[model samples]
Target: MTTRQDGERRRGRRPGGTDTKAALLAAAREVFIEQGYDGATVRAIARRAGVDAAMVNHWFGGKEALFAQAVLQLPFNPQELIANLLEGDPDSVGERIVRTFLTTWDAQDGGVFAALIRSVASHDQVANALRDFFIKNVFSQLASVVSVDGRAELRANLVASQMIGLGMVRYVAEFEPLARTDIDTLVKAIGPTLQRYLNGPID
Candidate 1:
């Protein structure tokens, strides 16, 4: 049953499923942007992509992984970052965090992170998705090792705040001194603040 519209025949999956992954990624990005991470279901993404729901799992593992690959496009993997950060001394985790994060972003030197921040800032849905993604992926990992007296959620948010601030000034806004400073300088200046946010007693 082929329907002809605009003098073109609609088609189904190709023999080899050449575009399956690409289709999923494209559909996931749109669905995520419109419906947000929570609102966008794997079924919905698959439906929109013209593939079976199970195909999402087969190709991308699941929704969260799909979202990370499709929308976030982060240069480094969150799990890998956690593993590397944990390899160092527990007390120096804060410094490791700053250095690793800055190094990753700096080496990439691409506008992907900046664009992501801009997207979150401009759209409510995207902002919500980003927050959820961060809490689930980034902050949760940090909170695992960073022991706060209480208000762990607040502590996570505070750590996020410091990282976001650094990103904004150094990468997005290109603020002087901070932007021009080397990675070590940044690690020195910002490391202790993040350390405190991660483990210090809240007053």
Candidate 2:
């Protein structure tokens, strides 16, 4: 009953089932790079992946999450990560954020983040994709949640500046003691400032 196309599908990517996630991620990356964030549609990515559009929702929760995983190459879901970051003692959220950031990048030896930093320099789409993502998904949401001073937007940007700077120095620039500093030390040192950005004065 098996056909040549079936054999080929078995060797490479298939229409649905177990291959859906990988196929969708592959397709999402292509579509996001080619179409940009605003232009890339769920149907288009699903069509490219040769799967049902609902599969995108089923696997990734929706377009934004898909973009985060596919384009940003983030290891976890942004929304869920934010929600988890919001849990427990509110004051320590920034510490958790720093810890999580270091852990995620360190696990990959900063390879993924390093590549992203490099790609952002030369590729407009990559830069646009990154701007469309972390700024909105990670920064805005987390900052907004803890913001009591109505400065969520500014706070978000500040927090972002810190993380972006940290990534560049530690991963890309490979600068000094900061690069070799342990995650715990970085968290303890940077966390209070981040907490202030999210909850403290910015006048």
Candidate 3:
């Protein structure tokens, strides 16, 4: 192909060229933050990235997946945690789960996770991604390991609440008591609630 054709293809206009996945992700992040998930359309993101809408779909399944990659900025691929949760013992699942999550966030390069929490409160798409990540990636994986009669969904939600609350005080609101606190201290304070959510009776 000619240089121009090659360049066009690389920009996601034709077949057999470099993927514009990273560019679309960066654009999606900006658009989502500025316009929010509900307001940010595929066309808008594409326009920001200077690529075609088809490229968004080609690179990411849809806005939902794109939102997952762009907004959350999780330190590790969630699937790995999901797999570990599925393989672990059920009784102590909550503590393990909490520790795993904390370890992941604590290791991030700062602000990425905080940014995600801030976006979720204001952006519908980002909120949806957060919810879906918990359901599909976190809770569902844990469900495979432990069966709690009829409270699986509720259990998942409870765990999310705990995590979100921790995130808010530590990252979003930056509450002095929680923000400045060490991870071990925070873990000791919150681990019991998480333990209950995982294994205690759900009334």
- Give lDDT per model, in order: 0.75, 0.77, 0.71
Q: Give all candidate RMSDs, comma-separated.
A: 6.2, 6.1, 4.8
Clashes of each: 0, 0, 0
Worst 10 residues of 3 by lDDT: 10-19
**Of candidates 2 and 1, the better by TM-score:** 2
Taking the tens digit of each residue's C-alpha lDDT, what string does model 3 give over 1-203? 12544445545553423446766888887787677667889987876665678888888889888888887753467788668755656666666776777777777644666667666777676687777767776787767644477888887788888888887777667788777777777667787787777667767
Candidate 1: tens digits of C-alpha lDDT, residues 56-154 = 888888987787687676556776787779676777777888998888888855365665676677667667777787787777777677785667888
Using lDDT as the measure, which candidate wins? 2
- Model 1, total clashes: 0
How far residue 194's Cα lies from its native spot in candidate 2, in Å, is 0.4
| Predicted structure with the largest TM-score when compared to the true one | 3
Query: Candidate 1 lDDT (Cα, whole model)?
Result: 0.75
TM-score of each: 0.68, 0.69, 0.73
Which residue pairs overlap in candidate 2's backbone?
A: none
Q: Rank the candidates by TM-score, best first.
A: 3, 2, 1
The C-alpha local distance difference test score for the whole of candidate 2 amounts to 0.77
Better of 1 and 3 by lDDT: 1
Shift of residue 160 alpha carbon in model 1, Å: 0.5
